[model samples]
Target: MSPSHRYEIEGCEVIWAIKDDSIGNTFFDRGAAEFFLPHLTAGKCEENKPLKRLKYTVTESSSDSPKKGDTAMGGALGPDWKDGWRMKGKHDQAAHRVQVEYQCEVQEVLTREEFTRTGQTAECFPGTSRAEEQNDDWPVYVLLTNKRLYGCDFVVSATGVVPSTGPFLHNDQFSVAPDGGLRVDDHMHTSVPDVYAAGDVCTASWEPAPQWFQMRLWSQARQMGSYAAKCMVADRDGEDIDMDFCFELFAHVTKFFNYKIVLLGRYNAQGLGKDYELLLRCTKGLEYVKVVLQAGRMQGAVLIGDTDLEETFENLIVNGMDLSPYGEDLLDPNIDIEDYFD
Candidate 1:
């Protein structure tokens, strides 16, 4: 069954927009409400007025599409994600269509007084007041607003990706690109010398996704930080660094109303599935099983509804075990494989 569109934010359970309902989604940071632009603008104009707003519309579709009247606007630049322009849409005969308009740069930070008082800018945008909008250099306090502050060397353009979603990498040395993203060389140490970054801040290729990828999950950020630290420490010790671990071993499980969804590895990884064998079964509700193989060994897998099997599944994928030895007997409901997992 197709999963329903549902998510809990700040304890609010939100569902997709239905027919004759004017319900809309919101995009917000700790500061300003970014996704509420349409509503805000709509409030400022007549109901039938064409929206003269600055926003992004998807340029094309790569695979999936959103539901009717559903509009997903955000950058996909986090761990296990890519950095690029994304377009999401849905079709609903009853609700008004979510129209994508123009491209815009969303500034979510502090105000003028707060910026000048301290050299740091807040994490939110509007940044500071109009009075403090003149300063161009970092270490210079340009108040993005009254509540938040930041210490930035430069502001780079992250135009291709979504705005306000913390998908940029966090680096020790900060530099800005002309397009609004940051540039840094120290975070993770690599087999290649002096090339590293962390968080949703960098344009480095070593990231989970390519440049312009939007990343915001805290776990992804922490992992990036840890990996970068490991690299830096390894370099300081003159160690023969191994870069293999940088590859992501993804696992995620979540509920959509009544149904559960689980994903493993980088199932989205291009061409990875070409050589892999797949098995699927439908029992209680919907259960999906995918096994990846390379040279007759298990490379990775995905399991829905049985996260308890994560370790066993991960072991098989990572070690490239000869799953052929067990065959379909492994799926026998009675088999307890946990004992064999290390």
Candidate 2:
């Protein structure tokens, strides 16, 4: 029987089906956060690039020398951030306890009736917490997918975004990026003369800095619009304009889940690929600081909570200084990073 009220749910098991696209890796690791998040992501990426709107990195490295490090330790700071980020415990329980997932695609979401009609009975419980207390007394619906069924109750949709290019999709007179953002030059000029576009509707067609790339974000949109105006003014007077310094390296400051977030450069080691390494340090409650290093140069970072390191990190990224010499001391949570760099 289909569910009616809370009491009416006793006989029928209602389950939200989430199909995981990660193959042969086991089903539990698929879309674990999306399955739990109350809000789904609403962002688009460049075509073939396929960027995710949000991702989490864990800080699990304390290597005194060098190693492939985790990127999440930069966010755990809690109370002592203003006082030079003086965090207490170095390792809070365990550093790598969090299971961070990304690029998890939900192939489909099927209703209970559809699941039954299709006759999928894959009993995969990767989504179930290992700490789950057995509640066999509570009858639940039979859950299954092309991947496997999850122990957690609730439906998950993995469609992050499809760009709304609108009427511009069919116009051949102007160039378009694969994501349908109007192709814009460094000066924010469209292919057609006298035409200008910026913000979410535009994409960068020029070569970008090593640690810089475009993403659909509030800060970027504001920066783009402002720069486009300047470029327009410069063009009207026939004056040449240099690309804004803001495009030199990525810098984003905002709040997420009540914590102040500062992302600089390739915060998540985006395009660095296998050659990059991460340095992470954190206290459980206070802050998380993650630094990305490629061949000993600062490439990017993710800073969470209130540990004040944005200015120093931003300069380091812009300067492209080699930091392989510092090793572990680079991310010491107790040190005055700004003072040292100064």
Candidate 3:
């Protein structure tokens, strides 16, 4: 069930089948504010403001960092980003508490029944485990895993979307990707000419642009849907249509750990390996900025906080302009980087 419907659904009892009762680590994409914020709020209005002001601590240092330093401690602030710093600080404090309380582990999920009847039952009183509470008369079913057994009545599958193509793939009419998504061409058309697939249900079949690849994100889904419509119309009219420009570069704006995060192109140096160089500027608790450069040209960037550098970086990446002359001065705090671009 989505976090939005957690409180709205009535009559049917909602049970969370989770490994632990800790509030953090409920979301898979730590950078997704939509997912992360809801879990933190948990259908509470009062928690919303505080959640926005929470400062996210950078626990692990990035491989590209010069020295192991806390990215959330002190950092240069962009204009109107004092709030960003405050929020990150608060989030860091809260995150520290959660870290101390909950040590997360990755484990395979099992059905509630499969877990309960595993022949390893440990009887314990209520409130001992963070799992659901049953009637005093009814014994709580404790499901055991390699890490720990969680006590709960019903298990909620909040894990994520799993591609299930077994039923459709059984038919000989379609070709499916190894990942189980329907293989689709640049036009978003599937193997069957008349049939087309888009969004999470389809795998990109065309040679992707250097800066763009498929991700199962809402933004990509929207782009695919719109582009697929145009492709379908062009096919109906027997007109050729070029692929949409949105696929030329990857762009995503989100909030992670209470800071505005903008990921552009190969933000993590995706397929570039060690062939690229990274220039980073971090203000502890203020902001973190990372730019990926390849062959002296800007290829990608990760902008945290309200850095107001997205347009400049995006242009630099799309245009493939050489910034080697500027060197590290491209990220120099004293320079008006945007003005330089102008």
Candidate 4:
């Protein structure tokens, strides 16, 4: 998940420790593994050949699980891709190319670990039972369910994040959200005056816009930090400032599994109930575009692959333009939607 492995840090050695052998799990926003695996393989080279060129396997429990990126993943990519010319497309292509070109084996591992006696030594490993010591660098391990045994360099647990609330919550000075996050007002101010919280640590306390909700994403963290700073300055001058417009609607753009992912507003049809309608156009191995509409206006959208429709869809969601007349043709690949909207 980090590119720092490419450089040598003086007086520092970084080891990525995780409980699981494979990367990315339910704890991660979907498609995170796809976005990150390439970098990980790219960092490891053998005989001047990048590891990405080697055959590898990506194992998952469920067949449908690999397709999690088909829907909105509830996370945002870094904003650096926002304005760069063709940067978004190129990044998407790279991710997809890695996915298609790489030799990935996907299968389910039913039992992660089980205990059984082997006619071996009593050396202990984290997950498995005692086994006989072998003349290997690391301890020998067995999978009872799969009837397999292997040796490895080390175990790294890549489990997801858990909120650290010991310092703030245990003190009883601040209010906590149901999800164990510190609750903050629209100004990003906590229970105490002149004390504010931003980023993943704080839960949004203000009344959210109809189309907007909070996600512990990097983009939102940056937005909250900036908004909190503005709020602090305004308080010093006794001036008032409205909440930043970024919170009015949700817009996220990122790449996953080599596909361009753009999500806007309630991309997953969140809170829309049964009244909303969905229009979809999908080309196998090419693109998947889905639009959410309430009445006649765009409420949200998910555009995957190089559709190049983010700007138009974003405007449509914001302007509340009625597309009922165009109906299904709104997503027609043959149409020049940009010019039509312009």
Candidate 3 deviant stretches above 4 angstroms: 1-97, 100-146, 149-160
Q: Candidate 1: worst 10 consecutive residues by lDDT?
A: 1-10
lDDT of 4 by residue, 1-342 (tens): 322221111211123333343443322223333444544423222222232222324444455555655533333334332223331221222221111112222122222232223343322333334453222444324222223333433333323345466687657789889877888998888997688998888889889987788877776787888899999999999999999999989877654443557788888778899898888877765777888899998998878778888888888888998889999999888999988897
What ranges in model 2 sit over 4 Å off?
1-158
Please give, for residues 104-182, the per-residue lDDT of candidate 1 as tens digits: 2223433455565554534322324546434344353322222223334333332323223244335434445444444
Candidate 4: residue 286 Cα off by (Å): 2.9
Candidate ranking (lDDT, best to worst)? 3, 4, 2, 1
The per-model lDDT (C-alpha) reads: 0.41, 0.60, 0.64, 0.60
As for TM-score, the candidate ahead, 2 or 3, is 3
TM-score of 3: 0.63
Give per-residue CA lDDT, model 2, range 16-113, as digits (tens): 33223331122112222222232121111112333344433566566776556545354322222222322122332211111213334345455555
Deviation of model 1 at 198, angstroms:
1.0
> Roughly what TM-score does model 1 have, to 2 decimal places?
0.41
Model 2: residue 297 alpha-carbon error in angstroms:
1.1
Which stretches of candidate 1 lie above 4 Å from their native place?
1-196, 203-218, 233-248, 253-262, 340-342
lDDT winner among the candidates? 3
Model 4: worst 10 consecutive residues (lDDT sum): 4-13
Winning model by TM-score: 3
Q: What's the count of clashing pairs in each model shown?
A: 63, 18, 16, 11
Cα RMSD for candidates in order = 20.1, 16.8, 15.3, 14.7
- For 65-151, candidate 3 gives per-residue lDDT tens digits of 556554535422212243333322212222211111133333444454565567655443323342643332223443334345544
What TM-score does candidate 2 get on C-alpha atoms? 0.59
